[model samples]
Target chain A: MNLKIALLGGDGVGPEVLAQAVKCLQSVEVTFNHHFTFSPALVGATAIDQTGNPLPDETLEICKNSNAVLFGAIGDPKYDNDPIAKVRPEQGLLKLRKELGLFSNIRPVRVYPSLIDRSPLKKEIISGVDFTIYRELTGGIYFGEKKLNEKGTVASDLCEYSEKEISRMAHLAFKAAKNRRKKVTLIDKANVLETSRLWRKVVTRIGESYPEIELDFLFVDNAAMQMILNPAQFDVILTNNMFGDIISDEASVITGSIGLLASASVGTDFAMFEPIHGSYPQATGLDIANPIAAILSAAMLIEHHGLNEEAQAIYMAVENAIINNVVTSDLNPDSRFGTDYVGNYIANSIVDTD
Target chain B: MNLKIALLGGDGVGPEVLAQAVKCLQSVEVTFNHHFTFSPALVGATAIDQTGNPLPDETLEICKNSNAVLFGAIGDPKYDNDPIAKVRPEQGLLKLRKELGLFSNIRPVRVYPSLIDRSPLKKEIISGVDFTIYRELTGGIYFGEKKLNEKGTVASDLCEYSEKEISRMAHLAFKAAKNRRKKVTLIDKANVLETSRLWRKVVTRIGESYPEIELDFLFVDNAAMQMILNPAQFDVILTNNMFGDIISDEASVITGSIGLLASASVGTDFAMFEPIHGSYPQATGLDIANPIAAILSAAMLIEHHGLNEEAQAIYMAVENAIINNVVTSDLNPDSRFGTDYVGNYIANSIVDTD
Candidate 1:
């Protein structure tokens, strides 16, 4: 099978880590009977420097033409230090997400047994905790109508939602719940905000179509407490943009290393996958960023493109590597291995087993 | 000086915990020179059943006559399961807050030295983490215009705020900060909701008057994350209703025990003190629910009334109790003591020789 991937290696450590991912994918292709195409495009700060547009026409075109897009981290310290700047690297990524119709972000929070002790939580509290978080990416505050009043004394952003915007994601969440734990807990502040009430109304109405799945809710405040107190009770959790952004990160820390999580943003016919960690410029060229997240992202891409067995191969390889202590320095700081070595070990395990 | 205190022991464990708090205060008044007259009143589920109103006129009259109110937990499980019930227990507490103009809720999240290991977070992450949250109690979504549209498909709750609503609390928050770390982090989702913009608008303007204090703004999403990742960085956090409701609970877990926190709701002249923990109905008759929070709320009350030395005395006793393992089962399960014994122990410690 041929897989055509659009690789948007944006800026900072984006290019470095992405190269390692592509290299790992190529090795997997060579060992197994697979053909692939990787089309690299400029975006974020790099695009702005080359063409004065963060999400250039060329980059969007490549993303439009591919089966799946593999994104690297984006952002520059230069723009971060200058708070008054009109353009930012984060805008390009947000704009790309909006334009590509990537409405739902699927971030999987899983704990590796080897690193459980590293968690701040006791062994009993964090053990056996695994869940997928489906965050409504496009609709909330991120893309809401933001405006500053003329006097600069006030700035307003509108958090409005149409029923259709929530429908597509709720459907996916219900299906996921059906396969996993048969439970979907919708997180929202229905008792407080109008926007939250709209969310509860829409999701609760849509939930009726999938009666096989148990539906429950929690106010955002209570939900935040419960996430830390007991995370084992959740399975396929669904929430809006802002709540998802906060809870997913908080949930990420439940596992000892946040560097092990992978996420995918998918629309009707297109999908994009990436490791959930940020651009660590300090780790640039050092080749030690716990590449399993990136490798697992590749696994998601393959599964997303109708290669279930091949995707499992990638999943099992990484899991086996973790179980056997074949990890990068981030996961096992005492383990003297680079990102490439760990990636190669996982790739070899994938091909050698079958 | 004599002060009339209206004690509303609303439901289940409410009476149990409030009894412990009042006992401590009674001892304090005898040992010191302050005298508090306790007038009991019925509210919540009990009131709704007998008088057909949670906030009955008699209860309101008692409250009006009192100098300060000591509110135990409200809400009953009987009313909780029914979604359509209009005259509910929570309505009484909400009404009391609105009627009495108790606009600012002061919640303190402190990591106890003895139980910091109980945190889901790493030990280093939660150590020495002490911050007070100032939540605007009477405005934003709770009091916003809520409407169930003619179309059953859509429901909207309006979130609106004006200059005065935010300014008064902003100034109070700055005043509190001046007495502590001299830094206030304003938590708002200004990039999403119009009400937040209004909050930011007025608060920023009010913040200018307190130039000696440091000011920083955090989007509600970032504040939630920071509360977990690095809670110690915050000194005084000020936010609107909904954000505060969420972040405070998140901050509660970092302290590792919801039973350890207390809050005070204050208005222009009236104030209400209550433990931050909810009415644990299951533990009501078991004599196991922690009462340190309730007793601490009494401490805050005495301080609010300008009995600073007495307030410090209570703090020291509570600290000593926690340090000496003279705690309830929640904090020290094997410490060979129940709730009543621990409450008595703390009150005894208040009149210490040291």
Candidate 2:
């Protein structure tokens, strides 16, 4: 098998943690006898510093020409702190998503048995929790036409959705559900917003194609509450961009392992995987940032390309590391392990596996 | 003191639970020696069934004429289950808020010491979880202009905010914070939305006037995660209507007492108090619905009218009832006490107080 993977180590601890994922991928290549090429591209604040453009033209080209892209993280405090800054690091990732046509952001949240006690929720409530969120990207209010009156006293943002957009993500959610629990909960405010009504109508039609999968609906507010009260009940949660941003983030913390969550964003012909955690600007060069999320993202990248066995090998290695408490300070505060040690440990585990 | 109260027992268990609140209020009148007039009106599905209107003109007239309005729950499963129904039980509430200019919706989430064990979150995360959410009502996405394209394939909803809308709620939140921990966290998506940036600009200026109050900002997504990860860190959360609806609901469950949560919607000239819980259509005639929320709303109504001592008395009596285990089945599953019993016990506790 031959694969070309684009690496976008955006900013802060991104490059540091992403290097660990590369080591694991190299180990996979050695053990599985696969030919893999890695293409490194600059993005976010790093790109801005060198090229003055968050998403340089060459970076997008490399990503477009790859089998899949494995992203580390984006954002920088220097840009975040200045409210008046014209160009931002996040705009780079947003542009990359748009340019690559990556429209569905899928995040899976599962409670690891070894870390169940670390969660804010009771062990009984979150013990068996396993769910994925299929979020519609590239549409909705985030990309909507924004307006401010001449006097600057009134401001507005439009939240728009097309049947095409709704059905695409709905199909993805249904497809994912077919392989898992066979249930999909569409989170929207159908009773209030016209867009939500359209979501319900379109998703309902999509559900018919996958007759074996069960379809249900929950208002966003109730979904937020239910996520805490009984997170185990959910299988696949499909929602629009804004609601998805809130719900997925809320779901991330429930597992007590934000550092271990990974996400995949895909379109018709392109896919990108990344850790859900932001670039920890404070942990830059400190060698203390967790690398499991990035390593798992590398696993998702392989899984996206139908390399299931290879992906599972990486997953098993990561799980072994977690169970043995070989982690950075974030997971085990008393541990003296650094980012390199954890990454090298997981990579060696993957290679050493029969 | 003399007062006139409008009671709108809306739908399902609304009337039943409201009857309990009225009993407690009657006890307050007897003990505090206040003259009060009670006027009952119809709203929600009951109003739709009886008068063919959710918010009848006569009901609005009664509410406007009264000094304050104490509302019961709203909505019915019949109306909710029918997606095409033009008139909904919730339309009454939205219309009433608009007509009365109720621009601020305030919900206080407090963890009751007696109900700590019921919380889904570990005790350490929820203990001392006392915060108030000041949600800007009568504006934003829910009330925004909505459009479904001619082809019925596209839909959009506008989220608009004016300086006035943001400032009024900012003042309420800041004022509340002055009486609280003197910190206000504004939740908005300022990083992406033009409206949120406007919110930040306006709220930041408002914060200057509140020199003693500390101000901070959090994106809605981060705010949702923080609400669960560390709920006690918040003193007052000020946000737009949509975020408030979701965050307040999320905050409600953390206390493990959604049935005991109360809310107040107020304007310069009019005020309305109601339980945050919806009318449980399934529990309509079962005599199992919790009345504590409605009773607490009655307490807030008195507080709104400058009856602090009287309100505190009601709070103390309700707390005593909860402490003594005189609660409905919702709070104590083993107890055989029904809604009527809990209501009578709290009412008697109020009257017997020294």
Q: Highest lDDT, which number?
A: 2
Residue-wise lDDT of candidate 2 within A1-354, one digit each (tens)? Answer: 899999999999999889999999999999999989999999999999999999999999999999999999999999999989888999999899988899999998998899999999999899899899999988999999999999999999999999999998999999999888999999999989999999999999989999999999999999999999999999999999999999999999998889999999999999999998999999999999999999999998998788888998999999899999999999999999999999999999995345
TM-score of each: 0.93, 0.95
Q: Is the docking of candidate 1 incorrect, acceptable, medium or high quality?
A: acceptable
Q: For candidate 1, lDDT tens digit of each residue in B180-221?
A: 899999998766676677777787788889998999899887
lDDT of each residue in B190-302, candidate 2, tens digit only = 98999999999999999999999999999999999998899999999999999999998899899889999999999989999999889989999899999999999999899
Which ten-residue region of model 2 chain B has the weakest summed lDDT?
B345-354
Clashes of each: 3, 0
Name the candidate that leads on DockQ: 2
- i-RMSD per candidate, Å: 3.3, 0.4
**What does DockQ come to for candidate 1?**
0.49
RMSD of each: 2.7, 2.3
Residue A130, model 1, lDDT:
83
Off by over 4 Å in 1: A83-86, A141-157, A193-198, A286-288, A323-326, A352-354, B82-86, B147-149, B190-205, B334-338, B352-354
The regions of model 2 sitting more than 4 angstroms off are A78-88, A351-354, B48-50, B77-88, B351-354
TM-score of B-chain for each predicted structure, in order: 0.94, 0.94
